[model samples]
Target: MSGELRVIATAGHVDHGKSSLIMRMTGMDPDRWAEEKRRGLTIDLGYAWCTLPSGREIGFVDVPGHERFVGNMLAGVGPVQLVLFVVAADEGWKPQSEEHLQILDVLGVAGGVVALTKRDLVDEETLAIATEEVLERIAGTVLAGAPVIPVSAGTGAGVDALVAALDTLLAAAPAPEPARTRLFVDRVFTIKGAGTVATGTLTGGCLSTSQTVEAYPTGRRTRVRGLQTHKHDEAKACPVTRLAANLIGAERDDLARGHVLAEPGSWRPTTVFDVTIRPVRDLERIPSRGAFKVYAGAAEVDAKIRLLDEPFARVRTAQPLVLDVFDRFVVRESGRQRTVGGGTVLDVGPPRAADPRHRSFLARRAAAARGDLPALLIEERGAVRADDVVLLTGGEPPTPHDGWCVAPTVRHAVRDAVHDLLGAFHRLEPLEEGAPLGVVRQAAGDAARRAGAPRAAGLPDTLLDLLASEGSIVRTSTTVRLATHRVALEERADDVRALLERISGEHEALPPTVKELLRAGTPRDVIDAASRAGTVVRLSPDLVVAPSLVDRAVALVHQHAADGITVSTLREALGTSRKFAVPLAEWLDAQGITRRRGDVRFPRED
Candidate 1:
């Protein structure tokens, strides 16, 4: 059986033996810079790996511990699950140790093992006292109850015990599930033959050679030429492990350390985002407005903070970064040069705080557990495309209602609005059988936007069909109406009867014109209502005739079945003038009752 692969990072004060501990355990020095070895300090991030006793392959990210290199430290620890915390036995806990612990706690590192390095420099009693102090300092931190093993990198004593502890901790760590691939580029450089190489901790999903990837901030598309982990070439790289990908189609100058390589179109880059934050350590305040640096993934951005309410705030960056909800971030007061706090991202591309729905949405997010947030977001949105839900929340939509994740309340509201709009349309134009399809779509789209489902604008055809399937509305190929709606001329019955009598009895073959009807005391609406009721047919803007006259016209055309009928022939047959015959012939052709060629007509084959 193969054990799991995991990545762990080291954190402590400057020169606290974090690099030395990794070297002793992994048989490879983590400090890669020549200056680092000569200066006896780790400067930038370093990487090394080793297999544990249980066969689990573990990678170590060695981070700089100096106060000035805290940004580098944050980049290393931001994406990993386990921590190898180092506190010198002689020095116990220092300023950087306190700062590092606070950072780990806020960033939500789930598991840890504290290393009491340089144990050989202190006696047994001093070592015991140092262990006690470290425990007290980390009591309420993420490393609480973590094993503190005393070790000396020079003599290699107790290094075995620390390794065993790490293996045990990793054995209990949750396994990484397959997901969308995201690799924050912590290191970018060029090789002799490789065009450009970017390295970072891989998370979210897997990366394989020849796959297309996109870089954030730059938005450059590139392909992976090759992959490597622990100095060995690999065809694929998995999550929660350090990875270096040789990229094609991009110059080394086009990439940078803070950039990210992800599956094309998998991430959205935004300069502004919302988060729920808590102050770190004894810090009691997070200023509503200030210059701050946000450290997330492998990116550090300058930003301005705005407080919406307690624990809820918005940060607008000077440049864009790829981010997701539930991602952890650390914030440092730019001027003070100290860790202020960190938080979990709640929303990316949030609406203005002044928007009416902003606070209410945040309230629901605050009340939801991490796993429940995606579903809650979909519910709050009313309806969203299933693909969009995955992109926005990094989780699948609860259940797609015909490709849209719909909330019951918002769906009901939209349905009601559709009914109301159709009702208004019927009241205004009672002579029409139903509303035009385009008009109903426009009205339904407005209602959906108001109900919190912006993507449902124009109310997709599928949703319209769904509404019809539920019997909320009746729809034809070109029109829509409420199921309960019907066209009725009962209130205009007397006027309709008068209009029909004038058309059928007074002017049967050549009915009265629209102007003539009005002059003869017939209201225009009554004429229209009679037409809708099938008592009369309006063949033209000015011509109104009884349906019986149309039947007679069709009978006359059939009487000439031996030869195709002409407009002149129909006029003579009906004893009417060419004015009525021309429109009547055209109407027959349009309805496919007759097919016209030039001036003659023939019965349609239908």
Candidate 2:
């Protein structure tokens, strides 16, 4: 079986043999710059790869170790899972060694091997002492129990043992799982024939030639023209492997060191994140409320940390970082060059609150840390999109209906609001069918706000539709009401009903006007209540007729619909004058029951 690929990063003080050790192991110069070769130091990130005795391919990232280039060192070590920590045997332990170890610990690197280089310059006894010092230094770090191998790059002593140890270390490393692919671009340059080439340690998923990708935080889109892994052309590059992608449609100047290349829409940019932090044990005090630098996934950003209690804080970054939940980041004091703290991101794009000191805001932060989707739903108090929950928690998508996931508590709150609003409206206007749909939505929003619940904008339509579908409420094009709601008329309703019946029975085509009813001492409120209750149908401002009479007139129009019916024919059939016939005919036209052509009317096809 073919062996899987793994990436290992080199770290130590300047001129500590990191580059020379990689050159000896792989027989390839990791320092690509001519100036670096002349100065005998690694200036930037360098790459080389070799296949071990077991045929397992190991990629190396040679990083600069000078104090001024610590940022460059972080870029190399941020994404790799294994480290090859180099320390010159002549110099037992150095300042950069401690700094690099702290960084590895901050980044949470789980596996590593220590290389005691320059063994030729030291005796056997001295080499043993150097090895013991290195072991003591890494005793409490991520490399606590890692093996130490003494080797000399100039003489090739112990080189084979070092390679064999690396193979063993890699055999126990976990295989990468398929996920959203993210390539933190550590190098960007222009090739004569290939527009822009970007190289980095690819993680999360896979990349293939001809696939489209986006440079996040910049949102620049480019297509992959070709792919290379370990200097060999490949159709695809998998996670945890070194990759160089030739891109189309962009210039080299458009790309930068901190930018990330990812599949489109797979990642989102966030300026503020909620995180859980662990201050370095040696720090005198936590830099809780000041400017700091954050390093994560090859991106270094200036940020401000606001402590929200112990161990929990909010980081506001100057530049947007593409991150997911549980991603690790290191924080360093601005202008101090010292590691202060590091933590895992609990939430990207956390919810905003008007008052940070509010208990609800603190509760929301706690909920985000625990990744409790149900708690978020309860806090939202309404329907939330399943996609949003997945993004927030970095977990499986929640169960959804009609593209919305609603917690049972929130769903119950909406249902109760609807019920109470409809009950109050029914009590106030007993003769009416229900309240207007807009009124119910306004009430629901107000109740949510008063209860400190999450009020999603434009969610009432979904709730009402769901309720209506389940038979809890009655929904129409213009109104909503309880399923059991019915019109309840007052004591004076009988008198008004008697008047409407007499008028429609006497004159089937045109009944008494609203003005006539008010003039005859029938209360206007009573008339309006009757109209709203569907007992009386108002065709126009001056025309009020019984619903039964309107149905008869519609049937008459339908019978004559084959050709057309004239106003004179309608007037003669109903025994009404032109004064009443004109308005009734116009009302029918407005209702789409009939279409008028000249003085004749025909039933509307629609």
**Best-fitting candidate, scored by TM-score:** 1
lDDT of 2: 0.81
Clashes of 1: 0
Error of 1 at 135 (Å): 1.2
TM-score of 2: 0.87
C-alpha lDDT values of all predictions: 0.85, 0.81
Q: Residues 1-606, candidate 2, lDDT per residue (tens digit)?
A: 146788999999888899999999898999999999999989999999999998898999999989888889989988888999999999878888888888888678869899999999999999999999999889888899999999999999999999988999999888864456889899999989768999998977788999999998899999999999887899988888889999999888878888889888777789998877877656755765667999988899999988776667788999999887767888888778887878777667566742454435445654464445445643553445667665555555566667667666656777888898898888887666678978887876665455544566666676677778779899887778899987666566677766676567665565667787778777666676777777787777767777776676678798898878888877787777887777778888988999999988999997
Task: State the displacement of the C-alpha of residue 291, model 2, in Å, after optimal TM-score superposition.
Answer: 4.4
What's the TM-score of every candidate structure? 0.89, 0.87
**Residue 285 local lDDT, model 2:** 58
lDDT, model 1 = 0.85
Candidate 1 TM-score, true structure as reference: 0.89
Clashing pairs in 1: none
